[model samples]
Every structure is written in C-alpha cells, then in structure tokens.
Target chain A: MSERTGVIHDIGYRPYTGPREGRWGIVAGLLRHGALSTFGFGRSARSKVLPFGLLVVTLVPAIVFVGIISFVGMDSELLNYAGYQQVTAAFVSLFVAAQAPVLFTRDLRSGAISLYLARPLGPAAFALVRWASLVLAILAFVVTPLVVMFVGGLGAGAEVRDELPRFLVALAGALLLAVLLATVGATAASLTMRRGLAIGGTIVVLIFGLGATAILQEIGREQGVEDAAAWLGLISPFVLVDAVQHGLGDAASSFETPPDNPTTAALMLLIALAAAAAALLLLVRRYRTRGSR
Target chain B: MTVIQTRVLTKRYGGSKVAALDSLSIDVGEGVTGVVGANGAGKSTLIKILLGLLSPTSGDATVLGHDIRTEGEAIRTAVGYMPEHDCLPPDMRAIDFVVHMGRVSGLPPAAARERAADVLRHVGLAEERYRLMGGYSTGMKQRAKLAQALVHDPRLVMLDEPTNGLDPAAREDMLALVRRIGHDFGIPVLVTSHLLGELERISDHVVVLDAGHLLRSEATTAFTADTGHVLVEVLGEDAQSRMGQALAARGVAWQPRGQLLEIDPADAPPDALRDIVRDLAAELGLGLVRIQPQTGRLEDVFREEVPA
Candidate 1:
C-alpha cells in the first residue's frame, strides 16, 4: 500500500523565473483580478449602495477639483505641485489599503474561500494572486492621477531634463507606500472571514498609523521628550512620503539636500517590511485555523 | 489502491468528550461510497479531513496516496469538494464561477473555459449557466456547485450533503446523477447524507457514522437483506382465523399478524410458500392479495444499530 505511484514528470511543475518577470507577474495578476472584482463588487443591497456612494461623494469632488484647477491656468508653479502628488498618493493609499482586507475576508467568511481552496491552489498562491489584484486596484485609484500630474508638469514647459527625475522619485515613493499599505491591509484582512470586521480593522490601523505622530506629540509634551516624539512621527508611510518628497523637490521647486540618515531610514523600511510580513503570517495562520474548523 | 484511508481519524470541537469522528478508520475503493449518519454524527468531519480541509487530531490519513498532513495541496488538487453549506458567490454567474474554479485547479485559460462549459452542461445547468446564482433554486445551486467540482476533472469527488435542501423530486434527480457520475463517468465519488434510505437506493457501498464512530461499512444490498418472514394476505370472512386454521391443519409453522398471516419459510424452496398459500386460498374460496417475502429496509437497520 505504501509503494510509490509512477512519477508524472510534467505534473507539479512550476516555471523558472527572473526578478523582473516575477514582479510583473504579480502586477499582471493584480490588474486582472482588480478588473474582474470591479464587475462583482456588489453582492448585497447595502454593500451595493455604500461603495458607489463613496465613489460619488468622495472621489467625484476631488476629481472635479483637480480638473478645474488644472484648467483655471493658475500658476502651475504655485500649486505646490508636490501637494498634488501627495493627494494622489493618499487616494491610492485609502482606496487600496481599505479594500485589501475586504477582498479575501468576505470570501472566506462567506465560505466562498473554500471554493477556491478546494481547487489546485494553496495558501501562498491565493495570497499572492490576491495581493497582485489589490495592487492593481490601488493603481487605478491612486497611481493614474500621479501619472497625469507628471504629464501636466511636463506640458507646462517644465524641463524634462530637470523635472523627470522628481517625477520618477514621486512615482517610486507612491509604489513603495501603496505596496506597504496594501500588503498590511491584505494580510490583516485574511485573518477573518467577516468583511465588516476586516474593513473596519484595516481603517483603524491606517488611522492610528497616520495619527501616531500626534499621539506621540501629546505623550512627549506630557513626558518632556520632544526629539523622540518627532522621530516617532516618521514611522508613518504618509510622513515618510512627505519626507521623501520634501527631499526630492518638485518640478518647480528645489531645496538644499538634507543629509540622509541611513540608520533611521533603514529602521523605518524594516518596520514597514515587518508589518507587511506579520500581516501575511497572520493571514496564513487564519487560513490554517479556518481550514481546521 | 484505496481511494481514501484513515487510521483512527478523530476531531473534537468545544472540548466536548463526544468526538465528532470517534476514531473512524475506513477505506474507500473506486465507485460511489455513501456515508450515512444522523445530523451530529461526524460524517462531515470525515469528508472534510479527507479533502484536506480539516486537520484531524491524533490520527493519520491519506487520500489518493497524498498525506493529509503534508501534501494537502496535492490532495486538494486531485479531489473535488462540494460543501453542505450555501457557499456560492451569489453575485457571479454559474459558468463564470465554475470556470474560475477550473483555473484555480491549474487549468490553462482556454482549457478552464472549455471544461467549465462542459461541466455546467453535464450538471444540467446549460441554459441557466449565464445567470447569477442568487436567483437559482436550491436544486439549481446544487447543480452549479456540482459543476464546479466536476470542472477540474478530479480523481475523487467528495459531496457533503448534496441533497441537503432539495425537494424529493430534486433529490431523486441528484441521486441519479451521483450514480451516473460513479458508473458512467467512472469517477470515484464519496457522498454524505443523513438520509439512510436514500443512500440505500443509490449507493453501491454505504458507511454508517454514528456519533463520530464507524457503526458499519458494507454493501448496500447486504445491509438490507430479505428476512424469512412471509407476508400472507387473503380475502374472506374471518380471514385471519381461517388462514391460521389452514396453516395449523397443514402443520405449517405460522403466526397471525394483523390482517395477514406471517410464516417462517424455513428450508422451503423459493416457490413452496407461494404454492401452499395459493392452494389453501383456492380451496377455501378466498382471494389472496399477496404472499410476498418480508424484506428489511435500510431505515430498520439504522434503527437496530443505534437504539434510541
């Protein structure tokens, strides 16, 4: 009974990979999933209204304002063009970050996750595919605007020789921020099957992470530790983006380069990576636990 | 090779002393194997573990030669599962959902699409395949779920309560489908349901799970055998008394039971009981309704096995 079955060499095979291919594989997967989910977004009457209402109420106004300002011929130079980048970054973060948890959380809790798990897929594959999908969704909501801003900056007679580097820097910063947030959101969301809990929990963490600076300030003022509080403020990816943009300059504005603090920057990067990794681990643990149940 | 094997497979929830599957060890060969148990009999636990969806404590098992502990990914790929719950994504179309499942099972883009269509058609959902599953009846949803499981062409398919919420007519249809899947398609199927009589009707082999323990596993035919008791009915005045007197005069062993006479046809040829009853009825100018051999039902065996 214990004898081995005949080996099917072509079976259980995965292809070899290079770094660039792997990254785009993740990217393509995310885009496809995001597009598909867009069609299946509303399952219940209440959910149907909420997301559409949010898009109309929150996004429509911002999109219109961006359009109006761009057309008004206001000194493109005075717009703190970096502010536009930040706004776009925030939009991406908010949309992608909050959605990450809802993706798998709802499916699993509803027992829809079991449908996929019973197939040829495993935990790792499931997570990766989902993460890729979320990143693309974030791109649609967040990254597109930054690209528009960069193109606008170029059309306004901003020297490509000078402005191109800043645009690249801004794009890279946005990618890093979105990836960190999406990874965290997805990992955390995968911990439960309850969509409401997952979405609410992700929002709460983002709010805390965003507001950690102020909390630290109150603690510092009460305890007399201003410098440490200031440093703690840098823990936020939002603030980290601010620092990166502040250092990198805009299409129209350049500042004296500040000395790079390698240790502090490395520590912050490590923290982001760790949070993302922890979320993934928690999700894996959740899948294991639910499977057992 | 055995399609499934478990050694003392047990699972406990909420720290209760009554295990969901009390040291269940069973082997499943090719063809449809029906699992029968009451609502809380741990039949679901056994299916879940075999599909690598549940982790069994204090036991070792394998499905399709893949270890349940380490090679779950392989087992899951090779086995199809239809859960008892209403697990369908209501927003998606039936064909779309099944196609996605096929892709998840490692089929390439074109192949998954092709297989999805084939499966949906096979499950009798060809016309409604494009409709959102939310509007489907319980029977339609069951077929859609079954379509997804069959989409990947798995070696073994485990359907947990496939007729759970179906009407009697729908249930009979599902049972027929199960039989065809096993015999016609030649796929080994493991289906679970609390309806013992239903399983007896369709299943080639039946395994009874009682309170997380294996009560019995045997061929369905063997489980429901013809008892020697013969049911004799005759039409006349004082039918019971006259029947009894005739059997006594012939010195045949019998008992008066309700409006009929019961006889133990021991050591008699197959037609001997019929011959005696017919001749006696004719001589007494009595009309005989039936003289059939008494047979046990699957429900009777279930009751006898688990006394309440």
Candidate 2:
C-alpha cells in the first residue's frame, strides 16, 4: 500500500430531530396535495386551463343571471337557489369529469401510488383523502356561484331575513350534489390509468343516466303511471338531487317533476347514499389491493 | 444485532406453481448486507416482503422489531425503500417530490423541506433538484430516488437494483455512496443485485440465493479467506517452467499458473516457504519479480459451493 491518507469532511447531513406528526398530519398533507393537484397548482400553466376554465364556465351563468336580474330590475325572486343547480348541472358534470382524472388517474399512471402507500398513510386513508379533496373541489365549484348569486340578490335590494334560510337549504342541496358527483367521478377515474378514458367514462355515465332516466320517465307519464315515473327519476343523479330539493320544498324539477310523496324522497335519498357508499367502498378496495403493487 | 429476521417465509403468486420464496429463513445484521441472485431468484420479492408491500403466503418476519403482518405501517415508517422501477412522477420537480415524500413520512412541512434540501445535496443532486424529473438522466433519476430514501433519515434502507442502468464510472460512484451510507454514516443498508461480483467490493456480508433457495450466507472475509498458495513471477525466459522445476527438485510442490508459478506450501508454513522460494530462485539465476499469497474470490466460492 502507498503511504497516503485521506480525511472525510463533514457534509452536514443532519437527521430530522424535529417533531413528527402522526397519521392525521399525513392525511392532511395528502388532502392538501390532492386538492391542489385537482386545480393543477404545482403543474404547468397549460394544465390549469381545463379545470379552472370549467370552473369559470360554471360561475359565468350565475354571474350573468344575477347581472341581468339586477340590471333589468326584475323580481329578486326570479332565480331560485335549487333551480340554479339544475341549470348548471351540465357544467358541474363536465368539471368533475375533467378534474377527477387529475386527482386519481395521474397517480396511478405515474406509479406515485407506490410512493404514497410506502408512507405512514394506508390505502384506505389514501382513498379517503383523495375522495375528500374531490368533494371539496366539486363543492367549491357548486357553492361559489350560488354564493355569488345570493350576494347579488342582496345587492339588488332583496330581503335578507327571508332569503337566508332558502340560501342555506340551497347550500345543503349543492353539497349533496357535490358529494354525489365526487363519488361517481372519483370511482370512474380510479378504474383506469388513462385520463382520456376516465373523462369519457364519467361523462358517459352522468349524461347517459340523465337521458335514459328522462326517456323512461316520459314513457311512464304517457302511460299515466304516477308513482312509476317518480321512481324512475331515481336512476339519474341529477333527478335524484332535484327530488331531494323538491322534498325540502326549495325548488321545482327541470327534468321530471319531483316526487310528490315523502316515501319517494326517502327512496331517492337511500339510493343516492347506497351508490355513494358502494363507490367509496370500491375505491378503498381497489387501492388496498392494487396500491401496494 | 439482528436487523431483519425471517422464519419459514413463503410467497407464491396467484396462479404460479413455483414459489417465489419457499420457506426461506435468514437473519441480517446491522451493516451493509448484499443480497445476490440471478433473475427470478426472489431478491426483489424478499425486499418487497420486508417493506411490508407484499404479504407473505405463510410464516412471518419483523423489521426493526415490528411485525410484518399487523405492524406494516410501523415497519414502513422506519424503513425506507427505493424500488427498482421508475416510480417518480414525470411532471413534478425533484425538490417538490422529495419534500412531499418527506412529508408523507411524517416530517413537519418546514422540517421536510429542510431535510429534502440536505438529502438532495448529499446525493449530489443539488443543482438539478429544481428541474422536472421527466428531463433527468438515468443517473440523476437514480440519485433522486436515493435522496428521497435518505430524506426520511430511516433506521435502515432497502435499495433494489440501484445500479441497474448506470455506466461503469457511475456504477463505481453509486457503490462508493452505498459504502459511505453503511460505513461513514453508520446506517444499515440492504441492497440487492442480480450480478454477484458487483457487490463483492462494498458488502460486509453476502447472501446468495439460487432459485429462491439460500445458496450461501457468510461474512465477506470468510468467502475471500486466503488460500494456502503463493504466486511467483520471474523475468527470465522460460521463467514459469524453470521456477516450477527448480522448486520441485528442491522438494517444494509447485505448479505453473499461466506465466506465474504457484507454490503450494504442503506441510511448510508460509513464511518458511517464501524464504525457501527466495533462496531457490537466487541459486537458479532466475530474476524473481514478486511473490505473494493468493486469496480466495467470491467467484471461486460460487463454483465450488453451488450445487449443479
């Protein structure tokens, strides 16, 4: 051996001695990250257009409806809160279809789920966090326009005291719609790693369900089957939201007349709940089994 | 102390008749342990099972004293894993990805960011950390993967095929970094490779698996223990044969090993045999170049120990 020696200089790789939060902190971080990804926060500017554009599209009608009503000095009661959701249902569906893949499919396609699962967060927690973010995103989309409209009615000199309760009920209806759309959208996105396929699948499911249920309800109406027509409305999430709104005595249905009886409202609520739960369960199972791989 | 222990562990895929790991058992101590095998010899499967990514078909294991069955989360929190495949998100910058991974491992945001920067620098990716991972070279991607694994400051790290696609110089750099992780930082490292000889230089202990069965597990020194033979080189013409004949005439057993003469000290001690060879070469008027004892190699052990 040669007579040479070497010294190792310190590079300062200090271990993290700081406080480490537990599972809840991890879940919160993942939720925040997923929510940001839904709107393409950390991504390139080109990626931001679709989700935010649809969001703007969702808000435009509310702004125009409010602007026109305020400027024309029409009855402040002209635009109902629940009726706004019905009118904007297409925009909301498209928003979910476009953005849900950003949250769900990208992770699966890029193998980022492995990194996520390798941490303290379990597969169920991962699924729940993503679902929560999608719900929050859809909620923002649905509730922002309604809030703008509510404020516009106030600015137009509408009575605040009488309108506040209806506004709150409409918020509830909007939340229900957000949860339903999030579940269906996230479930569709979770089934595939292809973004285009996921978007197509979500749009097809929502639109086909709406069109099919409307045609079936028309057939029942021609046959004079009252209860059957009301029951058929449950097939579509849009009609289901309308049925719930009708039960709350807030707004009238735009597609098919809302169910008249309490039993129909209960059935619609039950079916919606079951579908959301089933979709959530599918998500949890899918991640639990395939996420580890 | 044992860092990882498995007892009768077995794993079989859904429709396969052959088990990936068949009732295998091993105890790995706290140091750099090299897991070597040919393709489909269950090296990756073993690492996956240790990380609690894949559940065993039977039996059990523990990493850092946490059960692989019920305490998978706990095990994962303490053990960092660098997978063999390309698992990084293409659109995300390396710094953001590493910071996010640090957060997922439970570090607070500020601490995660600080640690991410430090680990990136330590892995020699400080300048490239700001760029998106999609544009990174294979070497840079491998370093980024290594940085994420170290960012958590885990008790033990399991690296799978970290040198898979590197050139020779990069391979040496990575091996040196692995040695530093185990020796300088005093962290336990469990690294796997399909090539047996690649790990021979840095691993303190080597475990060889053949067809999912344990072929050998021993200290690196034990595998490379000295063989009782000294190789002799000379400068004269017909040097090897001349030295061999002269040594044999003097009752010293010797053989020609290529250009060098190998002297086997049958019953004599090495020092005495070396002196005898020196004297004999001087009297024979042969120019003695060098003489040194031969040490065993891992390739020799493989050829001698592995069953056909």
Candidate 3:
C-alpha cells in the first residue's frame, strides 16, 4: 500500500481526532479559563448592578445631606474621615457576609460549577480564582465608599492633610475586613448548593458572632465588670476598624493597646487571614468531592 | 484493544429497590457504537459513569486508558459529553457556550473561538448561533448541544438521545450528523437512543441494555441477518389467496400474513417457488408486485428482549 493508504488505514475509517493540536497544558489553564469565564463574571456583574445601584441610592441621601451641611459653612466635620471608616468597615463586612451566598452558591446549584470542574483546571485553582474575583468585587464596594469619603473630607476642609496615614490605615483595615467576610460567606455558601439557605445560614453565623458579643457586653455592664464588657466589643468588625482608626491618630485603641502595635494588630490580622485561608480550603475540598463517593 | 471497558459497574439510587446499573460489562471500540435501551434501562447511568460524572457503587471502568475512579479529571478533559437533559444555560449564546466548553477542554482562546465557529457552522447553526439558546426551537437546541460536543474535538464524544424532542426530519438530520461524525470525521462516537431501529441504521455495532442488564451486543449485521422469512406480494386482488394456494400445493412451509404471503425461503426450492408463484398469479389474472427477503428489525429484537 502507498503511504497515504497506510495513513488512512491507521485512521481506520473511524472518527479521528481532527488535527493533533499542541497545547501548553495546565500552566495556561488559568489565563484561558479566566478569559472564558469572563462571561460568567459578566453575568454576575449584570445581576449585581441593580443591588449595587440600590446601595448607591441609599448612600446618595446621606452624601447629599453631608454636602449641604458642609456647603452651608457649618463648622462641623460632616465628612469625618475616621467616622466614615467605621461606616466603611460595617458596610463592607456586613454587606459581603450577607451577599456572598447569593453570588457564590447560585452558580453551584445551577450546575454551572460543573462546567468549571469539567475544565482542565483543578479545584484548588478554581476555588482561588473564584475567591479572588469575589474579593475584588467586595473590595470595590468597600473601597469606593472610603475613597469618596476621603475626598469629601478634603473638600470639607477638615484639616485632613495630617490625617492621610490614618485614612490609609483605615482603608487597608476595611479591605482586609471585606476580603475576610466575602471569603467566609462564600465558604459557607459552598457547603450547600441552595442559595437561599446558604444566604440565610451566613446571616445567622454573622449574627451569632457579633450578636453574642453585644449581649455579653450588656450583661457584663450589669455585673459591673467594665473591662470584661470592653473585651466583648472585639467580636464586632466595626470595632476592629474603629480601633485601627483611633490607633493611627495617636489615640488609645478601642480594640486594644495601640491597634498598629506589632503584637496586637498582628494577632488580629492573623485571625482574619486564617479565616480566609480556611474558607478557601473548605471550598476546594467541596469542589473535589462534589457528586462523588 | 478496547477504547472503553467496564467490569461490573453499578449505581443504586436513594431508596430504590433495584440498582440502576447492575454489574454490567461492555466493551466499545472505535466507530459509531449505539447504546440501545428503553427508558430506565440504565443507559444514562452507563454514560454518566463512563464520562466520570457519576461515581460507581462498585466495579470499575476505564475510558481511553484513564481510570474512572481517580482519573476522572483526565477522562473528562479527554472525552466530550452531551447530556440528555436541557442543561444549557439558556441565557447564553450558542457560540459563547460552545467556546466556553472548548476552553474548558484545554483549548487555547483563539483555537476555542475558531473551533466554536466551525462547529456551529458544521451543525447548521451558523446564523442561529448568535441568538441566545433560550429562543431556539427544540431542533436548534439539539443542534447547539451537538455543536458544543464537537467544539472540544476530543477523541471520543458521547451523545445521549441526540434525537430527543425532534421531529422526523430533525431526527434524520441528527442521525446523519452522528453517522458523519463517525464515518466522515473518523471520530469514535458513542450515541444512545431509545429507538433501536434508528440506532440500527447509523450504528456499526449496537449494545442493548435491558433493565440494568446487558441484553445483547454485536455488529448490527449479525443480529439482523438471521430472519427466516421472505415476503412475496403480487399486484392484484386475491394475490394473497392465490400465493397461499400455490405454496400449499408445493408443500412449502409458508403462512398467509395480511396482504403478503410469508414463506420460509429455506424450506422451498428457490427457483421453483418463484416460478410457481408467478405462474399462479398470472393464471389468476394478477401481477407480482414484489418478491423480497425479510430480516429481523431492531425494534422486533428490542420487543422480544423487554416487553412493555
């Protein structure tokens, strides 16, 4: 037989893998998948815009009232940078915690997660990429507000030039809080495919953590144990940011002695980072064992 | 060598008395291998397990030399699967969805997009691929599903009920595409269909599964080549009666069946029977419309194996 006939015989008159194409394997897995799943992120963005718009609407009235008060020559710090930092931490942590299940669990329950798992990428990479995108989204929600507040404070002439360090610290603290809450919510949501139940579960978890602190502090006050009551405030995400803000401004920390102190701040940072890492591990494990024995 | 091999694979659903797939073993080689079974015959179970989408309760199977248990990630990357249900995210466009699937199979961005376009065109969805799949008709949706399976360009493609929810023309088109996928493209295609007759036409080999058990597996030719009857029809009134009388006079083993006469061609002398039947039909002022041999149809085989 001729060479061509031999090749045809090798092809065996059956379906052949159309051109033997070259691939770089898993190293390129991330870039290629990131490009493809851009559509998924686009879909997620479309779903988030309305709620984000609602949040903007809610903040608009406050922003306008603050602007009006500043414009009327009131000798007041309506755009107080430190005060806004407290709002930033509260909103970022609570909002991310409440919304994580909506953004994360819906994809899994809809079987869209199957498409990702079916890819050449492993569960570890998939979990990390998804968590990263979620963290970026949460950061946008939290950081945008803080940036606006900083500019507003400058415009309000609250002598904010000397307070740049404090503002920067607050920004970093808020970002860490946002990332931590987003990861926690996403991890909890990953345990179940049902979005509503996952969201409800996340809310209950956050409430339990922060609510118990508030209740403990109230009871401690009744028992006349003021120092013990103060310790319970550490559970609140807002309190952590307030502590950091006060520490940056040379004030006694609300959370601990010197919020920027290597020992105390490092411990807090470790706890937040550990939560994020644990959440990532849980998500990866769930992805690996999905629908399997 | 077997492209796919399974040994006693099984799946038991929750609270179910019987297993969905019970210790079933089958081998598939390259070509169009049609998996034939009725509803609830464990066809879906087998495909899912082979795709590594479902974990088996026991036993083992391998696809393209990849173990079904631990090597599922590799198996999935190498194999293409078109699920039976309406699993498509309807809001996405066909091209985008197929491109996404291609990327998932490790295709680079440029190659995935190029293959997606080519596959969409190949499936006859060139224009409709731009529209969201939600607005597509059933036939179009099936074609889109088919396009995604082809977009990845894997070594083996498993299609589940590609003709489901299709009209006759659409079903024929789908089957033709399946045949071409095997014959024209030289890609091994394992397709499942509840209709055995359809599979018989397109499949080089057919594997029959009946209630979680292997009923039959052979080349389509082998199962169909053993019919004992030949049907003879004459083009006139009373053709049946006249043919019956002629056969009886010759002592040929035959029976009258509806308008035509069914005769065991083996028992009758071939030349003499033909001449006698012709002469009798002519003498009775009738014409012989046709004389043909009959073989068992796949549907008949299915009915024999699983009665409903």
DockQ, each predicted model: 0.24, 0.56, 0.22
Q: TM-score of model 1 relative to the true fold?
A: 0.81
Computed on alpha carbons, the lDDT of every model, listed in order, comes to 0.69, 0.84, 0.69
The window of 10 residues in a row where model 2 chain A has the poorest summed lDDT is A248-257
Q: Which stretches in model 2 have alpha-carbon errors above 4 Å?
A: A1-11, B230-265, B268-292
Evaluated on the second chain alone, the candidates' TM-scores are 0.90, 0.90, 0.94
List model 2 lDDT by residue over A1-293, tens digit each: 78658878776657666788898888888888878878888876777898888888888888887888889988877768877877877778888999998888988888778777777776788888999999988888888988999998898888898678878878888888888989999999999999999999999988888888888888887888867788777677888887887875546667655688767787788888897998899899999887446
| Stretch of 10 with least lDDT, candidate 1 chain B | B102-111
Candidate 2, residues B153-251, lDDT tens digits: the string is 998999999899998988888988888888887779999997777788889999888777887889988877888888889878777777788888889
> What is the lDDT, from 0 to 100, of the residue A99 in candidate 3?
57
TM-score of 3: 0.76
Error of 3 at B4 (Å): 1.5
Top TM-score: which candidate number?
Answer: 2
Tens digits of per-residue lDDT for model 3 on B82-108?
A: 767665665578888888777667676
Docking verdict class for candidate 2: medium
Q: What number of backbone clashes does candidate 1 have, counting pairs of residues 3 or more apart or in separate chains?
A: 4
- On the 0 to 100 scale, the lDDT of residue B264 in model 2 is 83
- In candidate 1, the residue pairs with backbone N, CA or C atoms under 3 Å apart (3 or more residues apart, or in different chains) clash, namely A30-A132, A30-A133, A109-A193, B22-B212
List, residue by residue over A112-205, the lDDT tens digit for candidate 1. Answer: 7777666555555666667766655554554555556556655654567765666576666667666666776786677666767776777666
